[model samples]
Every structure is written in C-alpha cells, then in structure tokens.
Target: MPEVKEFRLPDLGEGLTEAEIVRWLVEVGEVVAVDQPVVEVETAKAMVEVPCPYGGVVTARFGEEGTELPVGAPLLTVAVGAPAETAAEPASAESSGNVLVGYGTGAPAARRRRVRRPGVGVPPLSDGSADGSADRSAVGDPAAPDGPEAGGHRRSSLRGPGAAATGGEAGPVAVVSPLVRKLAREHGLDLRALSGSGRDGLILRADVERALRAAAAPPEAVPEPTSAVAPRVPAAERIPLRGVRGAVAEKLGRSRREIPDATCWVDADATELLAARRAMNAADGPKVSLLALLARICTAALARYPGLNATVDTEAREIVRLPGVHLGFAAQTERGLVVPVVRDAHLRSAAGLSEEIARLTEAARSGTLTPADLTGGTFTLNNYGVFGVDGSTPIINHPEAAMLGVGRIAPKPWVHQGELAVRHVVQLSFTFDHRVCDGGTAGGFLRYVADCVEQPAVLLRSL
Candidate 1:
C-alpha cells in the first residue's frame, strides 16, 4: 500500500464543528502536490480554502459545493508517493501557504471520553468539563470514542459503560451519538445537564427534558418525588433555530450579552430633513425616507466624531475605526430584526440611498440577504420612529461603538415665540459602548446628529 494518509477535516477555527463547502479548486487525477488549495469551505466567519496536507494522486472528493461537513470527516482522498508528494519545487512554498481552514494548534478531544451516538462525535450530556470522572477504560480512541452500537459511535474508553451508558460514579462523556445529540441540540437542551436514566445512564431525549425540568425546579422537589408536575409553559410550537430567524437570534443574543450599552437622547426637528426626502421623492425619482436623510447626516457626523464611528474591543482594549461609513439600515422582518448595511453611505446620493434601502428591505423580507452582507458593519442606525416610537434605548451591536435610534416624527407642542406651537418634533437616541467612549462623547455625537436633522442646510456645508 502506497502510504495512504487520511486527510480528515482539520480544525478550521477554534471550537468550530462544521463548515459549508464553498468550492473545489482542483479536479481528480489532476496531479496535485502537497499544500495545494483543494477546497474552499464557508464557516460563519468567512470562506477559507482548505489545503491538501499530503502530496499524491487525487482519489475522491467527499462532498459537493454547499454541502456542510463535520470536522474530522474525510474531505478527499489522495494517494501519496506519486511524482506528487515529493515532486513539488522546494523553492516555491507560497503555493502551499494559501491553504486556510483547519489543522491548527488546539488540543484534540479529551482522554477516555464517553459516547452517546454514532458517527457524530458529540460529547455525552455532561455539565462539568471533561475532567476526573467515569471509568477511564470503557473505550479506546479519545477523539472518536463514539459508542459502537450505542447508535454508531465507536467506543473509545471503557469505564465499563459506568458513566451514563451504565450509570455509576462515572460522570458524563464528551462524545454523544448523532441522533441523540441532534435531537438535544434542536430542542435547545444541553446534554451535559442530563442525568441519564438509560441502561447505565445512557442519555435519551426524555432524559434531556427530565434534566431540564429538574434544573428549572427548586432543590426541594428532589426529595419528594411526588406526581406534582412542574408548572411551566410548554412550547406552543417547538422551533429549531435555522435560516434568517436563527441567524438574527444568534446575532442579537451576542449583541445583548456581549455589548454594554449606555444611551443619550436629544430632540431633533426633522422638518427640513423630511422636506429633503419629499423633494427627492417629488422629483419623480427613487423614493426615500427620512431614514435615508438621517443616514446622510450620520455619515457626516461620524466624520466629525470618529470615535463614535469606531468599534470597541472589550478584551483587547482596542478600538477599530473604519474609514468609510456603511450605515446599517434596520429592517423589521416578520422573522426578526435584520440590519443590512448601506455600504459607503457618504458616496451615495439620496436617490441611491432610497434605492438601496428598498433593495435591502426586499431582500431581508424575502430571505435573500447573503452571509457576506451581514458582516463588516462599522455602525448601525435603527429607525423606530416609523412605528410611532418616541425615543427608546436600543442595544449596541457587538464590537460597534454606537447605534442610533430614531423616534416618532409626530407633532409635539413646543415654545416657538414665547407661546406653545405645534412642530413636527422627533426624539433621537444614541447607544454607545462606554468601553470606547464616555458619556460626554456620546452626548456630543447625538447633539451633532440633532443639529444636522434640524438644519439640513448645515449638512450641505460639508457637501
């Protein structure tokens, strides 16, 4: 046998399980050398090219474009020792440097891990990290360790199945079966929390719920194992997070959890800005909203106060300032909130802004926005005023320094000439991450935005 090496999915990034196959760079029997760009895979982050680790004859491709594959699964087959493995020119190393995802420095799976299902190497439902617990010898290979016949996973360590599989002092294993893990994941249940009541504590879906119910209940209930059902809201409809709603939930959750927010509000008269929008629409051109006009003002103000137009890295203690202003237009989809970026908002005219907003809104509603469109936004603008909201605090998108919320542009009584007069007044709210800016800085930014909306001609000075 000509030394055939199995090139399983290499670790792409830290803690990533699977990636969508993007494209294949080379064809079978094309005589590829080592470290050549073999396939392109798309993760949540980006499309990175995976390079061939061993040099040889092309054997087989494991997947097709758009097919997502789990890490450690065979991607392709290449027979080493042809003019291939050693045939490459020694001086040309740049050709191999392009290989991107997987094959990194993270440690492989834990030692003596337990198994729950087949080929899927999901760890056994366990809360505590894989440390001291369970029989260390129930199976063999720590990485795989999927229990054979335990659904399809190969059994690695052999704690005599005492863990959940057999149920003894042994805790949970990291490896889980495919079907069980999939079910658990779909239900938003953490497998680790489950105390399997199966044969030896082998976790089941029922077990997952039981564990959840137990955790959700107070500690007093464990001793009195009576027939008292826990009073909880059963899901009207259990939903598996996927598609646009899933993406939105994930992004918003990250924004809410990771970003600290402080808000500053100011009153802005959008009378002139509204007029500008109407003029642009009356020109029999692309229709625009006050949002488009506000975006223009924000683009200008960001130039003045570059700090608010930047991103704050809470851990790294760094602020990334983007040069161009790509305003994120918040669209309320039936699914959830999706903010599509209007790239280089400063360069586009009012008509262009209007058109792009229309295009993005249509795409968001239709679920056609691409993944690339979702990332790389420097700042965001949310207009709640369309819904009659008069200034509300909005969470800042993670990493972004600030986000602006526009309230209802309704008539409000104000003192005009020493007497109260009705004016088309609006409230402006700005939420910024204090890690990057102070209250004074955020307040100054809102004031600037307010000024731009009230006197639209002031913005013309910059133009």
Candidate 2:
C-alpha cells in the first residue's frame, strides 16, 4: 500500500469556520506537486485558489464541486510513493471524521469561492453539495417525503429526487431563504412535498407553506402533526467546507479596517467631457464609457500627485507608490460586490480603456472574472454619477490612497466665460488616505481631473 496523506483544510483566514469549494484544478489519479494550485474555494469576498500542500498521486477529492466544507476537514487524500500505502485505500470512519455533528468529505468546500454562477443564479447549498443533485434533509423522509399541503396539511409524492416537476394539481410548496427554516416548527411545515427553487432543490420553509396553500384543503377538521406520505430513508451525503470564502472575508475586512481616508469634492463643467464621449462613441471600435474617461483622467492626475495613488502599509508603517495606474472598477454582482482591475490605464487610450472596462464588466456579469481582475487596484472609481446622483462622499477602497466618486452631469448654473450660465456640471469627490495624501494634494488631483474633463481637447493633446 502506498503512503497516503490526508490534506486537511487549513484556516484560510478571518474567523470563518467554513468555505465553499469552487473548482478542483487537480483531479483524482493525477500527480501533483507541492504548492501547485489544486482547488479553488470561496469564503465571502472572492474565490481563492488553494495550492497542494503535499506532492503525490491524487487519491480522492472528499467533496463534489460547489460544496461548502467546514474548517479542519479533509479535502483530499494523496498516495505517496513506496508501496503506495498512503492514499489508495479509504480512511476509517474515525479518521474520516464522519458524524452528524459537523461537515465532511462528500462536499469538497476546500476554500472560499468568490466565483459566481451566471445563468443559474442558485446560491450554494449550505452543506456544499449542489452539483445539480438533490439530497434528503434530516427534517424528512430521504425519498418521497410528503410536503405540507393547504391549510397546514401534507401532500404525497411517489416520484423521487430526480423526477420531473408535475403538472395538473399544484402540490405542496413554499418560498423563502435558508434563514427562514428555523420557523418551520412554529409554522408547522412539511418538507417532503416541498419543491424548492433553492440552490439544490432543498425545501425552504416558504416553499413548505406555498406548497401547503396550493394543495386541496383537508376534509378532517383537526390539523395533523405532520404530512401525509413518508417513505423509506434514502442515502445521504456529507459536504465538506473548503476554505475559499474564509480568505476573501479576511482580505476585505483587512482593507476596510486598516485603511484611513480623507475626502474632497469639486463640481466641474462636463460639457467637454460629454462632447468627447459622443464623438468617441460615434467612431470607436469600442465606445468609451464615462468610467474609462474618468480612469484616464485620474491616471494622468496621479502622475503628478502620486500621493493620491499610493498604498498605505498601516501595519508596517510604510507607504508605497506605483509608476502605472491600475484602476479597479466596482462591478456589482448578485452574489456580492466585486472590483476588477484595469491594468496600466495610463498606457491605454480612451478607446482602449473603454475596451478593457467593457471586457471586465462582461466577465463580471457572466461570473467569469478571474482572481487577477479582482486584486491589485492602485485606485478606484465609483461612478455614482451614472446613477444620476448629484454627489456624495465615497469610501476609499483600502490600501489604495484614494477613490473617486463621480456624480451626475446635469445642467447647473456656473461661471462660463465670466458670465453665470447653465452648463453641464459633474461633481467629483475624491477620498484619500489622509496619512499619505493631505487635503491640498487631494484637492490638486481633483483639479487636474477636472481640467482634463473640462477641456477634453487638452486631454487629447496631453496624451
């Protein structure tokens, strides 16, 4: 027998006790080297890749993809050399940590996963075993559990987990998030006939009640303790928490906590900026968004006032500056918020910046944005202006010295040609880490950005 080693899930970061397994880079039977990326997991912030801690032949992956696993659980078993005693054989029940108290191997939540699914927006099942498969809940008959019917009654179903959704009579059903499950007993819900729209068809309490309301009312006046049908138990599986989400929560929290900031704002005439956009949109391969223009302006401004683009090392008592600009554009996703970086924005043109920003947005919407897109942002732009807001102070996306919030462009009274007139005005709010950039520096950078936007022709010449 080969010498087998179990890869127990490590404390990814933060105080998170569990994570979801996103994907496995290395499959069973493949030879893996130490430190090679073997799997990807998500905790809360983003998906993180977990490298193999040991080198050997991959024996078994404890959980299925997209499952959440608790911390300190075994994720994979590897068979080392020699007689191959390491991992070819299965672990004993005791060593396997198999029990009802916590999560385990059937679900491979190796790490926190930030990766979101695009088309099917099913949030992960808490147990981590959502590979298009439904399982029996502890709350009911594993197979053919009768669900709550109308007026707090139960309905029966002979069909099993993989069976098709039936028509004609609406069976037991409900709708709700997982947090509502605790109220099941109080509300008197039956889980069996519950056709859940949840991640893996797990019966949510709302589904329980909806199913109950849709079914025929019981003839008997008295309410029963439970549903009508309860079949024999089916095979159940365990889900393991991978540590992916743990790492993300740690990173986001660290950023929010350690970074200190100060902010300044200015209203500028955006007629030129708007004109520039229209002209660019009329002729470009990829039309530039107001976001790309804002990025270009900020990168140029950072060139002079690098303080606004610096990174603060609060723990190390150090501040670092960069030569090029990497602007993280915040991409809102259903799972959560994500920011994908646009590398070296200064090097790219208005059109190039637009193309890159468009690409990242598409990837984010499609849930295909890579980890590289999510990190290393030297500065950030929150285009609240696009939402038609006049102006508001925006929080700094930590480490980076400052973040700019662009407010709406609307006709407002302003001095143009030494006369008060109505002009398209845009509000720019710049929040900087005061430790690195004083108010003057922040004000100066905002001024520079305004200059570029006000005289877009100069932006072309300056480039």
Candidate 3:
C-alpha cells in the first residue's frame, strides 16, 4: 500500500503569514516528481512557486486557485510507494533533498502506523468478531462505538462523520478538516448549530468564518415610526489596503504620527547641471540619469550633514547615525509607489547609481522586488517632478530621518547673474525630522544641495 504524506504550505519568509493560490501545476491522480513546482502563490511580498518534497501520485489538492491559505495549512497529499513487488524500494527513495520555507531535506520520514478507513490503508475484518475489535484497539479507542458491524469506522487522528456519530447521543458532526474546528474554537463558535455547505455536509473554514462574522455583526437598530422615508445615503467604495499599498500606508501613517517633521524649499538654477549631464552622457559609456545625479548630490550633502542620514532611537532617547548611505528612491509602479534602496550609494559614481536605479525600478515595476530590496534606508529621494509637479512637502519614509523632493526643472523666469532671464530652474524641497536636528542644520543641508544644483563643480570636492 502507498503511504499518504500530507504537505503543508511553508512560510515564504519576511514574516509573511499567508499567501493566495495564483495557479496550480498539478491535479489529483497525476504523478509528480520530487521538487516539482506544485503551486504558484502570491504573498504580501512577491509571487513564489512552492515545490513538493515527495515524488508520487498526487492524492488530493486542498485549496482552489484564488483561495488564500495561512502558512502551515495543508497544501496537498501525495501517496508514495507502489505495488508490493515494484515498491520494494523504501518510501525514502521518493524523498526530496530540496528545501523550501518550512520544510528542509533530511532523513526520510519514518513510517508511522495510522488508523485509516478501509480502501485507504488496512482492510477491516468482515467477521463481526474479536478480530475486528482487536484491529480497533490497535489504532487506539477500543472504546469507540464504530465497529465493523456498525458500517462506519473511526481513524485515531482523522475522524470522519462516522466517528462523530459514534460520540454517544449527539453523534458525530460532519467535519473533516481540523482547521475548521480550530477556527470555530478560536472564535467561540458552536459548530453543532451551523449548517455546512460542503460535500456530505462537511464543515469548512469558510463556514466557521461566516458563523463568526454573523455572531459579530451588531443587531439592527429599531427605528421609530416616521412621516417620511430618509434619503438613501451614497455608499463609498472601499479599497483594501494590502500588499504594497498597505505597507506604504502603514509607514506613511507612522512617519506622520511619530516624526516631528518640517519642510524647507529653495529654487535652484539647473542650467549648469543639465549642461554637465549632457557633456558626461555625450562621452560616457553608460548614460547617467538625472535622478542618479540628484542621488549623488544627496549623498554628498549627507556626508556634510550626517545627522540627516540617521534614525531616531526613541526608546534610548538618542539619534543613531548610520555609517553607510543606503539611499532609497521612490518609484511609482502599477502596484503603487515603492522605494527601492541602493546600498552604499555614497560609494557609487553617478553612472553606477544610474545602473542600479534602472535595475531596481524595473524590478519594482514587474513586482519582483524582494523585501530586502525595499527596506533599510538611511535617506530617501523622491523626484515627484516626473509627475510634472513644481513642489511637494513629501512624507518621510519612516525610520529614515529625511527625504529630498525634487520638482520639475523647466525654463522659468529667474534672476541669473543679476539679470532676469529664462533659465533651467527646479524646486528643491527638503523634509526632515525635527528631532534629528534644528532649522540651522536642515537649512544648511538644503543650501548645499541647492549649491550643488546651481554649481555642479562643487560636488567634485566630495567625489
């Protein structure tokens, strides 16, 4: 007989608790090889293909596509081994060495004796005698009332409807999945009073969750008799804050609530910067991006004002200055806005920063950016200018001390060289956590950035 092994969903790391099934690669009764990609799931961070460890016939699949399942929930069941003669090779022969989130490759699992219904594992005795009773005793519960003669049986670990029926007066409730029962227990719901919508009236987790929600819903308020009916109120559409959007919302909310932030803005002449960029690109190997140039400028400014590249240690009542500049730049994607970080931005040239920015931006747009790529930033550069805006006091990416916002650089009327002229001009807005420094430090940092923008040669000293 083939031994049935159940595989559970593994944690995809980064503290993700659940994933939604995007697609299934196999179906029931299909033979699968070890380490085969069984299902593709979308977690809060990224989409991942989960592989199975056992190579055998797929006995069952648990969740449907589009179903969201918690980590450790059953993914599928595989039956290992074949006919007695052909399956002489131990079940360990099908064990996989490839490891996933929760499961790791190790010694083949030792076979354990389990009580299962007939046609599943061991056959039950036909005679209504001592042999049948002894079989029941071997699998625990000699006291169980479901005997061979009763036309129903019970498994020690997995109790079906028959086992529920054998539980004295109330009999057995139709529940096969333990997750459903656990959900009911956690929510203080009684399964006996609810009707299940599953096959053979088996209780499901959705049923339990539905019962919980119904129990939680407030009672309808009684309205007194009125002369007129109230006008129908418009219903507002609600978008679920999850995935990238949820993460952004949480960080922004925290930054606003905890950080005593202030903003400072200045207009800078960018004709020289544009000319320098053109000259560099005209003779360069890899084209340098304007954002990358701005990023380099920010890094240099941070070296002069180190306090801006730091996070607040509220518990310790100290500001912790970071050593390396892990500069994060905001990129707008189809999934929403994401900030992909470039490690050691201070060490990179404008060209190097440009390449990394391109790679990370592409990854962000494709929704392939990992959790590591999105976190651990000392400062942020948000060029909202791409959206054609002139100025914005953008929120700081939480835990980071400051964010530099750049607006559109266009031909504007400005006093250049003591005369009013149309020059390439841009607005630079600096938003900093007030706890990290006073207005003097913030003003100094903004002034230096403006100077770099006005005179690109000033950055040569830092380079």
Candidate 4:
C-alpha cells in the first residue's frame, strides 16, 4: 500500500516562470531516492537538473521531452509507503529535507493504496494490494489513458498557445515541438482541426506550414494547368527568442527604451601596450593575455573616475556607486553572447585576470556557466575588436552604467615623435548612461583608457 504525492516544477530563481523539458531520468514504476534528479530542464538562463523530494515508486510522469511547463505545474506523482518485493523496510509518507525556491516538505503520514470494496464504483490502484483488485492504469498496459501518449498532450497545452489542443474524443492533438506550436499560434491555426502526418499523428513544423499555406491560398484563384513546373514557395524560418537569445533581446530592448545613452570614440596608439604585453609574456611564469592587460588598465581608470562605475537608482533618484569592481566580459558562444562576470576584478592582477577570464570563457563555450557566473556586474569591458571590426556603438548592457569597447589593434600610419610612422593603433569607444554622469566624467574615463593604451607606464602609476 502507498500514499500518492504529486511534485510540481520548482522555480529555478531570478523570477523565471517556465522551463522546457530537455530530458527525463525516471519512468513509471521505477524506484527513486530522495533528491535524485528526475528531469533536465532548460530555462532562459541555463540548463538545470530538477530533483524530486519524495523517495518512492514513480506512479506517473506528467510531461515528455520538449514540453514546456509553467513553474507550478505538476511534474509527476510518486507513490510513497509502497511495499515492494525489494522493500528494505516499512515506508512512511515523508518528504526530503532539502527545499527549492517554491518547493517544501510535506507533513509525515502513512496511508494505504486506495481499494474499492464490493459493488464499489472506483477502480483499485494495483492488483497486488490486499484483496487483488485489478489496476486500470497498469505500468505494462500500452492502452492506458494516463500513459506517455496522453501525458504528452497534457503537458504541451499546460501554458502554451495550444490550450485548446487538450481533451477531445479523437484524443489530444499530438504536438511535441514548441516551434510547431508557435507556428500554429502565429497563423491563428487550430491544432485540433488538423490531423498530423507524422508518426502516431504527431504535429511537426511541416504540418503547421501546410496548414498555413492552405489557409493563405485564395478561395477563387486556382492554379493553371500548364506543362511548366511550378515555382517552389519559399517559407520564412522563424527562431524563437526564448532562451539566452531571448534574454539578450529583452535586456537590450529595455536598455534602449529606458537609458539615455551616449557614445564617444577616440583612436589610440597601442604600440607601447603591445610591447609591454610581449615583454610580460616573455618574462612571466604564466603568460598574460592582451585582454587581461586591457582589463588591468580599465580597473585603474575606473579607480580614478568612480562616477562611471555606478548605476542609477531610478526610484530613489540617486546614483548607486559601487565600491568594488565586478567586471563583466562579453564572450560570444555557439548558443549566443553571454557576459561572464569576474567578481572583485579591481583586486586581481593581470595574470590573475587572465586566468579567471580563461576559465569563464571555457565555461561559456561549453554552456556550463551558472546564473551566478553570468550576473552581478558593476561594469563591463567588451573587446569586440576580436571580430576584426574597428569600432561599434554597442548598446549598453542594461542597469550597468557604462561599457568600454576596444577595437582591433593593427599597424596604421600615425604621427609619432613629431614624425609620421606606422604604429599599432586601436579605436576605443565608450557608451555610458547619461543618467549617471555628464560628458565630463565619460570623457575623462575614455581619455584615461586611451592614455593607458598609448603609454603602458601610465597604468603603473595607479598600480
């Protein structure tokens, strides 16, 4: 006998509301332990494995892979206190000690599996329990209504645009892909109205496209009967802005809407900086990166002009100047661009910054960067010049006061020592929130950065 308990999706933090099921670790009738990862889900921030709190036999799983569920939606039901052939001891209905953002332990109790008596209207839970009543939803039954087939439909429409796709006589609309769901929603197509051409009547992107094409065709106009082959109709590809790409889009949009931003540019001769970096790498135990040298210069400049290192508290009408520098560096990966923050960057040496930056960059590339690794930045240093571009007026990362953009350092003609010569020149662009400070502060910050780039010795003064 067992008492059934349902576990819902827990909040992964930072006000995220939903996540898509990337993988499922457990199945119905399988025994599980407390705090065991039951599913891997992808939120807007990162991928996380969610664990179940109850240790018991899995009775039901609510969602399939690729299904997006809201924060409070039921994920699965576990039958606790169940007596199995491999039972170690008598079980009681109790929860694990660990708690997530929106999940908690329940009261301890014990109950038997429900049994319908003689002339009873309800069905029994399992045939093995007490009086040998047959369970309608058996684990081995392929025709069970609460099995995988029905569960996919229930999870698909939980918080999606296809809410109408659930529960009908012909069975639930077989939609598994989120893109197909999105396509149907965009064209105002009812998924329940069409039969999917896929295996087990699963709705795919092609089926949604076919629906769109059929609906868009003119009622009166017909194709002419001609020997010439018809031209192929090109369909537009739509990518959903939901994960890291979506977060970037939303943040950038908000920054443009709220911040009165200004960009100032100056070209600097980086011959000396390059020479110093080469010399450091030649003599140092661990080689320092060019980006690290630039970051070192940035921290020094920020120390001189603290006004640019602050964010505006709009409601309080006060500028919040941060005491220590938590520097964020922009790194572009296969998934999308992410800014990994280096905590207490102002205190790190050039070699130390290089090491941390390398570690974070590798993490970003492998998509292992945590939410903590990606946030809490007092300032950002964007070295976009690695893309071989000279300069760009990049949109500021929202809430942060300013960003320092460094362009590619290349040999160019410049006036040096009262004579024209080829020198390593780089363009430095600074974008700052006007709400934080006037042009004087912004100009001072950029000027100091350019000075350090021109003369590496200028940084040693602050060091």
**Stretches of model 1 off by over 4 angstroms after superposition:** 1-238
Clashing pairs in model 4, backbone N/Cα/C closer than 3 A: none
Residue-level lDDT tens digits of model 1 in 8-95: 6777654557776655554443345556656666555334556775655554566654457888888876555533222222212122
Summarize candidate 4's per-residue lDDT along 400-461 as a digit string, tens digits.
Answer: 99999999999999999999999999999999999888898999999999999999998879
Candidate 2 vs candidate 3: the TM-score winner is 3
TM-scores for all candidates: the values are 0.52, 0.58, 0.68, 0.70
**Strongest candidate by TM-score:** 4
Span of 10 residues, lowest total lDDT, candidate 3: 133-142
- Positional deviation of 407 in candidate 2, in angstroms? 1.5
Between prediction 2 and prediction 4, which has the larger TM-score?
4
In model 2, the worst 10-residue window by lDDT is 112-121
Q: Candidate 4 overall Cα lDDT vs. reference?
A: 0.74
Candidate 1 lDDT (Cα, 0 to 1): 0.62
- Whole-model Cα lDDT per candidate? 0.62, 0.61, 0.73, 0.74
RMSD of each: 13.9, 13.5, 13.0, 9.9
Ten residues in sequence with the least summed lDDT for candidate 4: 112-121
